[model samples]
Target: EGIFELEYLDLEIGRCRILEPVKVKMVVAKTKEGFTVGGFVKTALEHPCTRCLKPVRLEINGVVEALYLPKNLASFKREKRLETLKNVIYYTGNIVDLSERIIEAIVVEIPQKVLCKPDCKGLCPYCGIDLNEHPDHVCDKISQESDIDPRFSVLMNLKKNEEEG
Candidate 1:
């Protein structure tokens, strides 16, 4: 059982920036086949909110687990090898570098839909106004356009036919 601490400065994960030095805790253990490496990383990031495009600060925590393959394994079919060892990582020499796996783990923690808050109102498509800033704001198109959806246009003429008859 071994422990290691890795710290990074100003690391960029996708479009977000790490605000401070982030530390990742690595735990390595010897296994029958090879070695197992597992770790957890925590950091604070600043990026534009997906909804309103406002700068928002978020805390991200990521966990990584990988199985290091031994160098003396027999060669097999590429497809069979990939299927059998989907999560296994192969190392050429004595040392195994986990930096790429750590970065991948952290990046996977990023949410697909990022918002300033849980119920953040997005910007207005017509006027380009932040709905969060003006909750009561209304666009002129709301009054001019019909409330009926375009998909329901066929049903609209039924009401007119009944009124005329």
Candidate 2:
């Protein structure tokens, strides 16, 4: 059985949950050359939407394959085993902790900005208001006709005369 535990970080990930126990399946096979362990990893977790702060669920599935080379001077620098060594998570003769690994996977899966819906009406740039709830807000459509620069008024008159001609 695989066991993992995680402590909460104070940062607002919004809301999230870990749904299932992490499953690590391993198999050892012996051939004329050597033995290797290869299998799959299954993990499930939840994340929160960055925009409206809603929970989003996720599942991670991956494979793990490593060659068990003898820890001896003769086989110390096997080139073929380099790939396996790079991918494998090594542990000293002690219980391996999956907590950090699980957290890492979850963090990697989180979207930079998660919207509640595809067409989410985000906050108004001018007023810093959420347009979703107050669709009827009149401030959005109140066009500022006075934004024109006073120095440009003579240019506007000149343009109008040119159009008339």
Best candidate, TM-score-wise?
A: 1
Per-prediction TM-score: 0.66, 0.47
lDDT of 1: 0.72
Name the top lDDT candidate: 1
Worst 10 residues of 1 by lDDT: 1-10
User: What are the per-model C-alpha RMSD values against the true structure?
Assistant: 5.8, 7.1
Give the alpha carbon lDDT tens digit for every residue of 11-97 in model 2: 365446667766765566764444556665566656554554455566657555554444352345556655546544444433444
